[model samples]
Target: MSRQVQINKIVGRLVAKKREAVSLTQEDVAGRLNLNTESYGRIERGVTPLTVSRLVKLATLFQCGIDELVLETSTGLTGQAQYIANMLDGVSSSDRDEIVKIVEKICALSHKKHLKSIKPY
Candidate 1:
Protein backbone atom coordinates (compact mmCIF):
# COMPACT_ATOMS: atom_id res chain seq x y z
CA MET A 1 0.00 0.00 0.00
CA SER A 2 1.06 3.62 -0.51
CA ARG A 3 2.77 5.35 2.40
CA GLN A 4 0.02 7.93 2.76
CA VAL A 5 -2.61 5.24 2.99
CA GLN A 6 -0.51 3.40 5.51
CA ILE A 7 -0.06 6.47 7.70
CA ASN A 8 -3.77 7.22 7.63
CA LYS A 9 -4.60 3.68 8.61
CA ILE A 10 -2.18 3.75 11.52
CA VAL A 11 -3.44 7.08 12.78
CA GLY A 12 -7.03 5.95 12.40
CA ARG A 13 -6.50 2.70 14.30
CA LEU A 14 -4.72 4.40 17.16
CA VAL A 15 -7.48 6.94 17.52
CA ALA A 16 -10.10 4.23 17.54
CA LYS A 17 -8.14 2.13 20.04
CA LYS A 18 -7.60 5.04 22.37
CA ARG A 19 -11.23 5.97 22.12
CA GLU A 20 -12.28 2.43 22.96
CA ALA A 21 -9.79 2.05 25.80
CA VAL A 22 -11.52 4.97 27.47
CA SER A 23 -14.88 3.29 26.77
CA LEU A 24 -15.74 5.83 24.18
CA THR A 25 -17.70 4.87 21.09
CA GLN A 26 -17.19 6.20 17.60
CA GLU A 27 -20.13 8.52 18.13
CA ASP A 28 -18.64 9.69 21.42
CA VAL A 29 -15.30 10.41 19.82
CA ALA A 30 -16.99 12.06 16.90
CA GLY A 31 -18.92 14.35 19.19
CA ARG A 32 -15.81 15.29 21.13
CA LEU A 33 -13.99 16.02 17.91
CA ASN A 34 -16.97 17.90 16.50
CA LEU A 35 -16.99 15.51 13.60
CA ASN A 36 -19.93 13.73 12.05
CA THR A 37 -20.15 10.00 12.62
CA GLU A 38 -19.70 9.26 8.95
CA SER A 39 -16.59 11.41 8.68
CA TYR A 40 -15.09 9.84 11.76
CA GLY A 41 -15.95 6.42 10.42
CA ARG A 42 -14.13 7.23 7.23
CA ILE A 43 -11.07 8.22 9.26
CA GLU A 44 -11.08 4.93 11.13
CA ARG A 45 -11.40 3.08 7.83
CA GLY A 46 -8.42 4.98 6.35
CA VAL A 47 -10.72 6.15 3.59
CA THR A 48 -10.12 9.75 4.59
CA PRO A 49 -7.03 11.69 5.55
CA LEU A 50 -6.48 12.79 9.13
CA THR A 51 -5.75 16.43 9.78
CA VAL A 52 -3.01 17.62 12.13
CA SER A 53 -5.57 19.32 14.36
CA ARG A 54 -7.54 16.09 14.62
CA LEU A 55 -4.33 14.20 15.37
CA VAL A 56 -3.55 16.56 18.25
CA LYS A 57 -7.06 16.22 19.60
CA LEU A 58 -6.99 12.42 19.31
CA ALA A 59 -3.65 12.24 21.14
CA THR A 60 -5.02 14.42 23.91
CA LEU A 61 -8.25 12.49 24.18
CA PHE A 62 -6.41 9.17 24.10
CA GLN A 63 -3.56 10.30 26.36
CA CYS A 64 -0.93 9.37 23.79
CA GLY A 65 1.59 10.92 21.49
CA ILE A 66 1.40 11.19 17.73
CA ASP A 67 4.47 8.97 17.57
CA GLU A 68 2.84 6.21 19.62
CA LEU A 69 -0.21 6.31 17.44
CA VAL A 70 1.91 6.18 14.30
CA LEU A 71 4.33 3.46 15.35
CA GLU A 72 2.15 0.79 16.82
CA THR A 73 2.59 -2.85 15.72
CA SER A 74 -0.20 -4.53 17.63
CA THR A 75 -3.31 -5.94 15.97
CA GLY A 76 -5.60 -5.27 18.90
CA LEU A 77 -5.41 -1.62 18.04
CA THR A 78 -7.70 -0.05 15.48
CA GLY A 79 -6.83 -0.56 11.79
CA GLN A 80 -4.68 2.53 12.01
CA ALA A 81 -2.23 0.72 14.26
CA GLN A 82 -1.56 -1.99 11.71
CA TYR A 83 -0.89 0.69 9.11
CA ILE A 84 1.57 2.37 11.45
CA ALA A 85 3.43 -0.88 12.02
CA ASN A 86 3.76 -1.41 8.30
CA MET A 87 5.08 2.09 7.71
CA LEU A 88 7.56 1.87 10.56
CA ASP A 89 8.74 -1.44 9.18
CA GLY A 90 10.10 0.47 6.19
CA VAL A 91 12.25 2.74 8.31
CA SER A 92 15.94 2.09 9.02
CA SER A 93 16.82 1.78 12.70
CA SER A 94 19.64 4.32 12.46
CA ASP A 95 17.49 6.86 10.70
CA ARG A 96 14.69 6.35 13.21
CA ASP A 97 17.06 6.98 16.13
CA GLU A 98 18.47 10.10 14.49
CA ILE A 99 14.98 11.40 13.86
CA VAL A 100 14.04 10.80 17.48
CA LYS A 101 17.08 12.79 18.61
CA ILE A 102 16.21 15.64 16.32
CA VAL A 103 12.64 15.71 17.57
CA GLU A 104 13.84 15.67 21.18
CA LYS A 105 16.14 18.62 20.55
CA ILE A 106 13.34 20.49 18.90
CA CYS A 107 11.00 19.81 21.83
CA ALA A 108 13.68 20.92 24.28
CA LEU A 109 14.21 24.14 22.36
CA SER A 110 10.49 24.78 22.30
CA HIS A 111 10.25 24.24 26.05
CA LYS A 112 13.12 26.63 26.65
CA LYS A 113 11.51 29.23 24.46
CA HIS A 114 8.23 28.86 26.34
CA LEU A 115 10.05 29.30 29.64
CA LYS A 116 11.77 32.38 28.34
CA SER A 117 8.46 33.85 27.42
CA ILE A 118 7.18 33.63 31.02
CA LYS A 119 7.98 36.50 33.40
CA PRO A 120 9.00 35.90 37.02
CA TYR A 121 6.37 36.75 39.55
Candidate 2:
Protein backbone atom coordinates (compact mmCIF):
# COMPACT_ATOMS: atom_id res chain seq x y z
CA MET A 1 0.00 0.00 0.00
CA SER A 2 1.02 3.63 -0.47
CA ARG A 3 2.10 5.88 2.43
CA GLN A 4 -1.17 7.74 2.27
CA VAL A 5 -3.04 4.47 2.64
CA GLN A 6 -0.96 3.58 5.70
CA ILE A 7 -1.57 6.96 7.23
CA ASN A 8 -5.26 6.65 6.52
CA LYS A 9 -5.33 3.30 8.26
CA ILE A 10 -3.56 4.74 11.29
CA VAL A 11 -5.96 7.66 11.43
CA GLY A 12 -8.90 5.31 11.11
CA ARG A 13 -7.65 3.12 13.96
CA LEU A 14 -7.06 6.17 16.16
CA VAL A 15 -10.53 7.50 15.46
CA ALA A 16 -12.02 4.11 16.26
CA LYS A 17 -10.08 3.93 19.52
CA LYS A 18 -11.13 7.42 20.54
CA ARG A 19 -14.73 6.70 19.70
CA GLU A 20 -14.68 3.48 21.68
CA ALA A 21 -12.96 5.18 24.61
CA VAL A 22 -15.85 7.62 24.85
CA SER A 23 -18.34 4.73 24.61
CA LEU A 24 -19.80 6.00 21.35
CA THR A 25 -20.98 3.67 18.61
CA GLN A 26 -20.05 4.32 15.00
CA GLU A 27 -23.69 5.15 14.33
CA ASP A 28 -23.66 7.57 17.26
CA VAL A 29 -20.57 9.29 15.95
CA ALA A 30 -22.01 9.37 12.44
CA GLY A 31 -25.12 11.14 13.69
CA ARG A 32 -23.05 13.67 15.60
CA LEU A 33 -20.87 14.34 12.56
CA ASN A 34 -23.85 14.56 10.20
CA LEU A 35 -22.64 11.52 8.29
CA ASN A 36 -24.54 8.34 7.55
CA THR A 37 -23.63 5.14 9.41
CA GLU A 38 -22.12 3.54 6.29
CA SER A 39 -19.89 6.55 5.64
CA TYR A 40 -18.70 6.54 9.23
CA GLY A 41 -17.97 2.82 9.01
CA ARG A 42 -15.90 3.45 5.91
CA ILE A 43 -13.97 6.13 7.77
CA GLU A 44 -13.24 3.73 10.63
CA ARG A 45 -12.11 1.09 8.15
CA GLY A 46 -9.67 3.50 6.44
CA VAL A 47 -11.48 3.55 3.11
CA THR A 48 -12.86 7.11 3.41
CA PRO A 49 -10.86 10.30 3.40
CA LEU A 50 -12.17 12.76 5.93
CA THR A 51 -12.58 16.37 4.84
CA VAL A 52 -10.86 19.04 6.94
CA SER A 53 -14.11 20.19 8.50
CA ARG A 54 -15.13 16.61 9.25
CA LEU A 55 -11.76 15.97 10.89
CA VAL A 56 -12.20 19.08 13.01
CA LYS A 57 -15.65 17.91 14.02
CA LEU A 58 -14.27 14.50 14.93
CA ALA A 59 -11.53 16.04 17.04
CA THR A 60 -14.09 18.15 18.86
CA LEU A 61 -16.36 15.15 19.41
CA PHE A 62 -13.51 13.06 20.78
CA GLN A 63 -12.06 15.87 22.93
CA CYS A 64 -8.68 15.46 21.23
CA GLY A 65 -6.51 17.20 18.67
CA ILE A 66 -6.59 16.47 14.93
CA ASP A 67 -2.96 15.45 15.24
CA GLU A 68 -3.91 12.91 17.86
CA LEU A 69 -6.45 11.41 15.53
CA VAL A 70 -4.07 11.34 12.56
CA LEU A 71 -0.93 10.21 14.31
CA GLU A 72 -0.21 6.59 15.19
CA THR A 73 0.18 6.87 18.93
CA SER A 74 2.08 3.60 19.46
CA THR A 75 4.73 4.78 17.01
CA GLY A 76 5.18 8.08 18.89
CA LEU A 77 6.14 6.74 22.29
CA THR A 78 9.27 8.23 23.83
CA GLY A 79 12.33 6.09 24.55
CA GLN A 80 11.71 6.59 28.23
CA ALA A 81 8.17 5.38 27.82
CA GLN A 82 9.42 2.32 26.00
CA TYR A 83 11.80 1.57 28.83
CA ILE A 84 8.99 2.06 31.33
CA ALA A 85 6.85 -0.32 29.35
CA ASN A 86 9.58 -2.92 29.43
CA MET A 87 9.83 -2.57 33.18
CA LEU A 88 6.08 -2.76 33.50
CA ASP A 89 5.91 -6.02 31.59
CA GLY A 90 3.79 -8.62 33.41
CA VAL A 91 2.92 -6.11 36.14
CA SER A 92 -0.62 -5.95 37.40
CA SER A 93 -2.81 -3.15 36.07
CA SER A 94 -3.20 -1.50 39.48
CA ASP A 95 0.53 -1.65 40.06
CA ARG A 96 1.21 -0.23 36.64
CA ASP A 97 -1.19 2.64 37.32
CA GLU A 98 0.57 3.40 40.61
CA ILE A 99 3.95 3.32 38.90
CA VAL A 100 2.72 5.68 36.21
CA LYS A 101 1.36 8.04 38.83
CA ILE A 102 4.74 8.17 40.52
CA VAL A 103 6.47 8.79 37.24
CA GLU A 104 4.03 11.60 36.42
CA LYS A 105 4.66 13.23 39.78
CA ILE A 106 8.40 13.10 39.24
CA CYS A 107 8.04 14.51 35.76
CA ALA A 108 5.92 17.41 37.05
CA LEU A 109 8.51 18.24 39.68
CA SER A 110 11.28 18.12 37.08
CA HIS A 111 9.31 20.43 34.81
CA LYS A 112 8.87 22.92 37.66
CA LYS A 113 12.58 22.80 38.44
CA HIS A 114 13.49 23.37 34.80
CA LEU A 115 11.09 26.31 34.58
CA LYS A 116 12.60 27.92 37.66
CA SER A 117 16.08 27.68 36.12
CA ILE A 118 15.11 29.52 32.89
CA LYS A 119 16.02 32.99 34.05
CA PRO A 120 14.13 35.36 31.69
CA TYR A 121 15.75 34.14 28.54
Candidate 3:
Protein backbone atom coordinates (compact mmCIF):
# COMPACT_ATOMS: atom_id res chain seq x y z
CA MET A 1 0.00 0.00 0.00
CA SER A 2 1.00 3.59 -0.50
CA ARG A 3 2.62 5.57 2.26
CA GLN A 4 -0.32 7.95 2.43
CA VAL A 5 -2.70 5.06 2.85
CA GLN A 6 -0.63 3.65 5.66
CA ILE A 7 -0.46 6.98 7.36
CA ASN A 8 -4.18 7.49 7.00
CA LYS A 9 -4.90 4.12 8.53
CA ILE A 10 -2.58 4.79 11.41
CA VAL A 11 -4.12 8.17 12.01
CA GLY A 12 -7.62 6.75 11.78
CA ARG A 13 -6.92 4.06 14.32
CA LEU A 14 -5.47 6.63 16.65
CA VAL A 15 -8.52 8.83 16.29
CA ALA A 16 -10.89 5.98 16.99
CA LYS A 17 -8.82 4.98 19.97
CA LYS A 18 -8.84 8.49 21.32
CA ARG A 19 -12.58 8.80 20.91
CA GLU A 20 -12.99 5.60 22.81
CA ALA A 21 -10.71 6.85 25.52
CA VAL A 22 -12.94 9.88 25.85
CA SER A 23 -15.95 7.61 26.11
CA LEU A 24 -17.66 9.03 23.08
CA THR A 25 -19.56 6.96 20.59
CA GLN A 26 -19.31 7.35 16.83
CA GLU A 27 -22.59 9.25 16.88
CA ASP A 28 -21.22 11.61 19.48
CA VAL A 29 -18.12 12.29 17.46
CA ALA A 30 -20.13 12.73 14.30
CA GLY A 31 -22.31 15.29 16.01
CA ARG A 32 -19.36 17.25 17.27
CA LEU A 33 -17.68 17.18 13.89
CA ASN A 34 -20.86 18.16 12.06
CA LEU A 35 -20.64 14.94 10.10
CA ASN A 36 -23.07 12.12 9.64
CA THR A 37 -22.37 8.93 11.52
CA GLU A 38 -21.58 7.11 8.29
CA SER A 39 -19.18 9.80 7.15
CA TYR A 40 -17.42 9.82 10.49
CA GLY A 41 -17.31 6.04 10.35
CA ARG A 42 -15.60 6.29 6.98
CA ILE A 43 -12.99 8.49 8.56
CA GLU A 44 -12.48 5.96 11.32
CA ARG A 45 -12.17 3.24 8.69
CA GLY A 46 -9.60 5.25 6.75
CA VAL A 47 -11.88 5.33 3.74
CA THR A 48 -12.28 9.11 3.76
CA PRO A 49 -9.65 11.79 3.64
CA LEU A 50 -9.78 13.82 6.83
CA THR A 51 -9.59 17.53 6.15
CA VAL A 52 -7.34 19.91 8.04
CA SER A 53 -10.33 21.65 9.55
CA ARG A 54 -11.62 18.38 10.85
CA LEU A 55 -8.27 17.42 12.22
CA VAL A 56 -8.10 20.71 14.05
CA LYS A 57 -11.44 19.95 15.58
CA LEU A 58 -10.34 16.52 16.59
CA ALA A 59 -7.26 17.88 18.29
CA THR A 60 -9.37 20.40 20.16
CA LEU A 61 -11.95 17.82 21.09
CA PHE A 62 -9.36 15.40 22.33
CA GLN A 63 -7.52 18.09 24.26
CA CYS A 64 -4.23 17.10 22.76
CA GLY A 65 -1.58 18.54 20.48
CA ILE A 66 -1.80 17.96 16.75
CA ASP A 67 1.62 16.44 16.88
CA GLU A 68 0.36 13.82 19.26
CA LEU A 69 -2.06 12.65 16.61
CA VAL A 70 0.57 12.51 13.87
CA LEU A 71 4.00 12.14 15.38
CA GLU A 72 3.57 8.53 16.38
CA THR A 73 2.63 7.42 12.91
CA SER A 74 5.35 9.52 11.27
CA THR A 75 8.19 7.23 12.25
CA GLY A 76 9.13 6.82 8.58
CA LEU A 77 9.64 10.53 8.02
CA THR A 78 13.23 11.61 7.60
CA GLY A 79 15.20 14.83 7.75
CA GLN A 80 13.24 17.70 6.23
CA ALA A 81 9.90 15.92 6.36
CA GLN A 82 10.32 15.27 10.06
CA TYR A 83 11.45 18.82 10.59
CA ILE A 84 8.46 20.16 8.73
CA ALA A 85 6.15 18.02 10.81
CA ASN A 86 7.75 19.30 13.98
CA MET A 87 7.35 22.87 12.83
CA LEU A 88 3.70 22.25 12.13
CA ASP A 89 3.10 20.42 15.40
CA GLY A 90 1.12 23.00 17.35
CA VAL A 91 0.03 25.12 14.40
CA SER A 92 -3.53 25.39 13.27
CA SER A 93 -4.37 23.02 10.48
CA SER A 94 -5.73 25.76 8.20
CA ASP A 95 -2.48 27.64 8.47
CA ARG A 96 -0.58 24.42 7.90
CA ASP A 97 -2.55 23.84 4.72
CA GLU A 98 -1.76 27.33 3.51
CA ILE A 99 1.89 26.81 4.29
CA VAL A 100 1.83 23.66 2.19
CA LYS A 101 0.40 25.60 -0.73
CA ILE A 102 3.12 28.19 -0.39
CA VAL A 103 5.71 25.42 -0.35
CA GLU A 104 4.24 23.98 -3.53
CA LYS A 105 4.42 27.41 -5.16
CA ILE A 106 8.02 27.78 -4.08
CA CYS A 107 8.79 24.39 -5.59
CA ALA A 108 7.23 25.45 -8.87
CA LEU A 109 9.25 28.66 -8.89
CA SER A 110 12.41 26.74 -8.06
CA HIS A 111 11.74 24.40 -10.99
CA LYS A 112 11.31 27.34 -13.31
CA LYS A 113 14.53 28.86 -12.05
CA HIS A 114 16.37 25.61 -12.72
CA LEU A 115 14.99 25.48 -16.27
CA LYS A 116 16.17 29.02 -16.88
CA SER A 117 19.66 28.07 -15.70
CA ILE A 118 19.99 25.45 -18.47
CA LYS A 119 22.70 26.33 -20.99
CA PRO A 120 21.53 26.94 -24.55
CA TYR A 121 23.22 25.24 -27.50
TM-score of each: 0.56, 0.63, 0.58
Candidate order, lDDT descending: 2, 3, 1
Candidate 2 C-alpha lDDT tens digits along 1-121: 9888887788888899989988999999999988899999989888987788999999999877677687654555684565456567789999989987998999899999999999995
User: Candidates 1 and 2: which is better by lDDT?
Assistant: 2
Steric collisions counted per model: 3, 0, 0
Writing each residue's lDDT as its tens digit, candidate 3 over 1-121 gives 8888888887788888888988899999999999999999989888887888999999999887676566554445474687677568889989999999999999999999999999999
lDDT of 1 by residue, 7-96 (tens): 888777876777787888999889999999999999998889888888888888877667666666545656655555545676999987
TM-score for predicted model 1 compared with the true structure: 0.56
- The runs of at least 3 residues in candidate 1 whose Cα sits more than 4 Å from the true structure, single-residue gaps closed, are 74-121
Q: Give candidate 3's whole-model lDDT.
A: 0.84
